[model samples]
Target chain A: MTDVASKEQKLSAEENISSKILTIYLIWSVIISVSIIIVGTILFIVTGKSGYNMENLNSLITAKGSLSTYPFYIQSIWSGVLTLKPFAIIQLGVLILLLTPFGRMLLQVFIFLYEKDTTFAIIALVVFAILLFSLYMVNILEALHIA
Target chain B: MIYIVIGYLMEILVASIAAGIIGALGGLGGGVLIVPFLTLYFHVPISLAIGASIVSVIATSSGSAAAYVRDKISNIRIGTFLVLFTTTGAILGAFIEHITPVKVLFFIFGIVLIISVIPMLKKIGEEVPNVERNDPLAEKLGLYGEYYDSVLKREVKYKVTGVKPGAAMMFMAGTISGLLGIGSGAFKVLAMDLAMRLPIKVSTTTSNFMIGVTAAASAGIYFFTGDVNPFIAAPVAIGVLLGAIIGTKILVRIRSSSVRKIFAVIILIVGLEMILRGAGVI
Candidate 1:
């Protein structure tokens, strides 16, 4: 009981710093991404055109439409960004939304290692490895589709 | 043409807010509601619906977790420790998503959800769990913490046990997240609150924190599949984020026991719907 209390006190002191950093970072990213999404949605509503095509809105809402096989490649997303396309901009927000957790996990693994918590550090490493592997799996799946 | 788009976007935005609130409260990741709403009502392609739901789940988890983690209520130790299982499970589930029929997947997920609720129903209104057993792994990993309960006006400390089983359950939770493009908060909460013997609030907020990481892995694959359409993702993300923020606010003020009951009921309803839908009745 006393040992538990001592441990709690120790964590609240140092763990406090990392927790604060995570909170601020998460908040800012969500704000940035949500802002971008709002702007992109507004731009599309007003202009009726994004770099891809205004017609995409048709299939977008259509039931069981053509979106299944259409994979929005990162390369195209980059090109779309260069052109300031609204849909691309929104996808950028989506990308950020997707990346936030990746960032958090990476940050956590670093923190665990820095604190010399080997067990958690190793666990976090495994999680990080799995995260990276999932991305690669996507490419493999896409390739298999082409083949 | 513009009006139609406006209507669709507006409707989704409103529905997503409700989904976001429920998801944040229950740690569900919001996909459970979003996918069905998009498909059954809007006639969205299953792939597209899955894509959008995965993205929205990310939004809800991150949005709600911001406060929970900052407040130190989310148990970062346990969250980080458990993420390994979920991430691995999610990868497998995402791969299976490509091969399996979604209805069959939802049915299994539904059964899991319903089963999880039974344990929770017995302990509804429990503010803090009284755990007697100790797991050496949990102790070595320091899987215990303290948080302030604003509603109770007291500091609550909790110890963790059942490390192996809880981790096993988290893997299933992660697979459900990947399979359904949801946070699978129900399963996560059950794993912690039941298997791991955590306080309901701790279980919920920690689940909220972990769901994002779990969903993010599979969401990556969904991205390239073009399941994540910007048109669908945009409003869902925006509304769910807004709603999740609201949920976190409500969470701190309510009694933990009530939170458990709410989680139980929500699980019950969503589970039944999924089963019915999976059976092609809906």
Candidate 2:
């Protein structure tokens, strides 16, 4: 009734700043997401044209056969025999960025009803970026046997 | 038939519904429900499933927290303070996960889940003091607020303290998140409700509000490390999100004490199973 409506209004007002930013971020994220799909498809097609066999490509993605290397902590049981595909790494990067700030923000605006402090919200976004970067680096290093 | 998309979407829808529902409940954190679904049902890789689960945890956190805030059930200032510690913990946990074995990581995670269920069964409807004297630290930290209680039919004011213990618990919660890829929902709620001793409602809302930021911090790393597969994550995230919303909506009406006990028992069984599997005993 009136109380519920008033409560909703008050809540929206409180979260106005964060909500606006979140909206902009969401739009940006969709663009990035579509781009990732396009790029992945193109990469897959071009790789196929270059005579990369679908069987090998699918296996690499499906984590069948020897996983080329331990990128993260757990390398799939398929490791020694199968040759590692280079495109998989780039695709993985694409997947990672797809879940980035823009992506996270897109989901957050739709999901959260609470108003977070703008400063804190911004900090959270930055921390998210850093965490992803670290993970990527860890995987890359592990793959290269650098670490 | 485009069955992959349909199957994927359907799976996500189910998980999201569950996460949403459980998240709305005061203490049944959404992460607990979502992770298992991803692992068992969809056959998602553990790392990717964990990544997706963490993201869904954030979604659940945001949805539930926002509702509670609108309802005037959460203490904002205190919640924010607790988030600072949990956020830091989440980052640390994500990095620590880089070094841990996946099987051992899951083993420990199941143990934590089992431990959390005990408290949820203890206090069903214990009313807390409305106006605790503001501790000096709480006063300085601005950890005081007022909320309207629906059951009591009045506005309730409270002062929050227990900074040291709250911070400690959040750190542990963060570690759990990093290691397990579960959202650490149960641990976060327990910390706020049991360790900080906030009202059940306040604890639940605040915990939900904070989880998204915490998960986001680590989920980024999860993605970059090639842990998030859209094919896998899409279904898992979507399912858990829908589930959590549904869970939250129905939470208040249900007799939660017995439900929580059952949930606890389920977690115990699952945890033991995972351990046995990991240990090669199963």
Candidate 3:
């Protein structure tokens, strides 16, 4: 009975940790995504243009200068964000939303490690690696002209 | 330019809000609604619409998932494990997206939406399933969870099985999501509920958790490819996020069977419209 009790306690403790981590991640994601979107919307209204013109819609559709040269654009996004460009700020918000799940998985890796659950920790690590690989492999493949 | 910008933003915002509400109710992500709406009604290019839709998927996933996570409705272990297969599939699918023609994408999107409706129609009004047996693989992977169902007013416990099959289905779901820029939650739920024998609530919530990660995997490719237009994506994301929050709140308070049926009908109509449009018959 005592052994069962101890196990239950451990499970609850783990649950608590998981819940806490998720709550923190969710809060940050909401704050970041919502704020940037609002700023972007307001700026979009005020400026009456969104960096990309309607004339470029055709080029955007065909992906003329975008996909092949995406890495440079990604770099520009960083600088744009740092400079508080409205569109970039909006993109940054979407970026944060996209990355939140990746962040959560990374947190799970630590949580599993702390629990001494080696199998699940390794599983989490593998998922993390896949996410990171997918993010960067596009650039490499584009450079190789194999994409 | 000002009139064009306002027109574009307002249209996407309104469309996204509708998609978000419909998506949340359906347990599918907003991408399903946004992609077709953008391409069919607004005449947005398929790739940019898809990019914006993918972003909206992440927004809805994160927004609704927060509430689900807090309620302990989502099975994180199952979601995380499946992410391995889905992410790999997403990468491959993203590559396919680059090479596929717009017409072909429309055809596939329409067909997929139609196909998804079949399962929903069959499972309409079905209650949570009972699975008494557990697979050894599930035990090893620790794929069991319990959540208090607010609607039922009781704690529901479930164990998963068919791990290999579920993972395979998730791979397919991920590929479809990447290719079409939708969440493909219907397939994810089917893999869990039908193949893995998990309860419906668990399946839906866990699928929600998984969608964000799967979309994230492909979102990177979309972002770098300049497919994600901030002007289009920004309002869509915000609108969908708001709609999803409201949907999540509603999800916990009501019986979902009726909601599922209503959502199914909506999906069926949309699916047929997409097919007709793609076939150039409309």
| Number of the top-ranking candidate, with lDDT as the measure | 1
Candidate 1 lDDT by residue in tens digits, B1-282: 777878888998998898888777776787877877777677676667888899998888887888887777888889988888998899888888888876886687578668868977887766788887568988888888778888788898888999999999999889888887888888898899888998888888898889999998999988866677888888889888888889878877777777667767877787787788889898
lDDT of 3 by residue, B121-239 (tens): 78766677777777888998888878898888898888778899999999999999989899888888878877898877888888998898899889888877677877677788888
Q: Which candidate do you rate higher for lDDT, 1 or 3?
A: 1
State fnat for each of the candidate structures.
0.73, 0.08, 0.52
Give the alpha carbon lDDT tens digit for every residue of B72-100 in model 2: 56565565556556656766777777676
Once model 1 is optimally superposed onto the true structure by TM-score, how far is the C-alpha of residue A93 displaced, in angstroms?
A: 0.9
lDDT of 3 by residue, A18-57 (tens): 7777777877777787788788778857875444433444
* Most accurate candidate by TM-score: 3
In candidate 2, chain A reaches a TM of 0.40
TM-score of 3: 0.93
lDDT, candidate 2, at A28: 48
All models: lDDT? 0.81, 0.56, 0.80
Task: For each candidate, give its TM-score against the true structure.
Answer: 0.92, 0.70, 0.93
Interface RMSD of each: 2.8, 6.8, 2.9
TM-score of chain A of 3: 0.77
Comparing 1 and 2 by lDDT, which wins? 1
| lDDT, residue B168, candidate 2 | 89
Per-residue lDDT of candidate 1, residues A18-78 (tens digit): 7778888888888898888888899878887655544545665642212232226777776
